[model samples]
Target: MTDSATSVFEADLPTLDYGLTDPPQQIYPQFRAAQQAAPVALGPIGPEILSYEMARTVLRDPRFVIPPGIHLSAHGITSGPLWDRVTRSILNMEGDEHRRLRGLVSRAFTPRATARMHDTIGTVINELIDDATARRSCEFVGDIARPYPIPIICALLGAPREEWQQFSRWAEDIFKIVSFDCDLAAEEPVVLAAWDEFDAYIDTMIAQRRRQLTDDLLSELIRIEDSGDRLNAAEVRMLAFSILLAGTDTTRSQLAASMQVLCEHPEQWALLRDQPELAMRAVEETMRHSPSMCSTVRSAGQDITLGELTFPAGTFIVVNTYAANRDATVYDDPERFDITRAAPPPILTFGGGVHYCLGANLARLELSEALKILAARVPDARCVGEVPWKPLLGLSGPVRLPMELCR
Candidate 1:
């Protein structure tokens, strides 16, 4: 932590309004103000926690658990039967159930499994880049970013290639339910319908897999055992849905955001072009600088006190990962986009502790390969239009990125 950064924490903190619709850059000032004031700030939803140390403590502490279903219901957002089933999967589980399910699925995402897909991922990236750059001027999100991740995940799960597009649409609709400023009342019906469709699709796939199992992540998940226990049909369906939900749009948005960042910083692009091994470093910096998922919501399992605030059991806690990643106390000139910065401690872009993102290795593999391929194939690519930002609460990224590729 720098001296100037130390001074920031010493200043009197200001009460800040947590706005869902404001762009992250616009909202960061308030985040800095709140972090300086205290570890946690009272917001409309409940208490919001900033600062790296406090945020990590809240995430790892068992006292802060997954939000209760009723709490989410109060917000007028329901996951319907399918998502309800998914919630029953690892995402909302705790204690023994979470441990069992996570252990079973952990094998599928091990580093070795993820590494085996390197050539496959590179091939997919090249194909997408070929199609995207063939036009010279392209909408990067729709052409490259959006289409890339879905099939890779589908291939990993043994999902039929023909249905990838439909699954992608379903994932997008399901995500709207979780967006910060979403009007739950208006979007609830559509979200429910999408879940129903997704549930039916997954059910059929599960049945098919049972009849003739394949060598894929989904099949492995179905048969995976922990202490001689296996996931049931509903559990398998839910796990598959959870994987699709977490893997698809988030990776797409992150890739798009990273590309936009590189296009804006041509020198960084040149750096990567000159030294391809820095691709992974660039991905990490992009994740640190402009993470797709910004904040995560958790409920206090019991009364807890930390840094001048006492959160009662059931109190809603929002962990501001974006703020923590940019805290100057932790990073020198934290806001500047620098890929060469000394490797700092892991950022909270992926939640830590028991709930650390299960697909993190897969995400890293996809991100690094995406950067490497782009640096090699589209070295001269440049942003061509005003990038439209996605107005989402828990996640941040570009929704539309137009780029011109010079061959």
Candidate 2:
């Protein structure tokens, strides 16, 4: 085993800048270089410093644990009142606790259940695109992708439609604070305010639902019973925060990126239009091309050996999904954006193993529905101006994707 003093370990990750001009290309080379030089290395730079990985060792290794405190500290978030609620999330849990909570939440995300939302999801997409058609030109992110997630999530959570925009505002800021690339110093106030507001709003909603339960996920979760036990208020709050944060920003970013890619690759756009049946394929391809999450970190649970290097317990493991998906060894001409490229293996856009994203099905539904509607309505839509892509660490893709709908 390699000793911590002189092992080929790398640290200094938080400060690593893959420059935002064209981040995908900029970061891909660095990740590929890291994979070759040392699968694990010091993070680029930052506090709570640790190592990062760019290989399949993450799946084979069993030493990595998802301890919430370690993960938060890695991002420079110190122990505080806010950290308590933040760490209670499923993403931070492991062992029995993780499995137990994940089981209950998994029920809401099963493929069969998500399939039931197709019609409603399609309706939202059609309405948004229809409105865009009338406008002729709009910022695809703000107008369509951004607004679409609210109604879908609101319906799922039993939140009222009248409060959609308010929730959207809260959801946006709340997720931003937690994202890897967030400027914690600047966004702390906004995030705290958003959480306070979300908590107050949810308390009112929960009280109302208790008085009159409905078919929404929130109401349903309230009534869910397992082994003669039900979820408490704190658990409900954590679940609500997870769903809103997980469901909204990722979906919005993916949808906007899909449109941006389609606009860039008109030939592929023509193919999608010609074969509307390939909407699912298009969604997967878009995810491969422009993933929402750039990376996820796991801590070594024990001394583990992989390749020629050994990771000590408590080491950080970084999985670069964007780089992994684009690895030339994994896919032919990985740089090309081909929706109809002979069915490819499931991409890591949603993740893999026990911690795969719970909202995968919902995201697929939203993307499929969005593309189906957009392709049918504005098949000739094109980029109208410069788009702004956010350099969020954990969350990524375009922030402002302006486009002009075909006349």
lDDT of each: 0.79, 0.72
User: Mind giving the per-residue lDDT tens digits that candidate 1 earns over 236-268?
Assistant: 878877888788878988999999998899999
lDDT measured at residue 125 in model 1 versus the true structure, 0 to 100: 91
Candidate 1, residue 388: Cα displacement in angstroms equals 3.4
TM-score, each model?
Answer: 0.88, 0.86
Question: Candidate 2 on 1-407: residue-level lDDT in tens?
Answer: 65443333553222345443345645665666654443344544321111123344474344566657543564577777557767777767777877777777776666886776677788788888778889898889888988888888877787766878888789878876556665765676788889989988887778888899976777766777778767777677788888887788788888888889988999888888888888899999988877766666677788766655566777666666776776666678877899997967668767666778888888888888788778878889899778777663556788798898985
- Model 2 TM-score is 0.86
* Per-model tally of clashing residue pairs: 1, 14
Residue 367's lDDT in candidate 1: 94
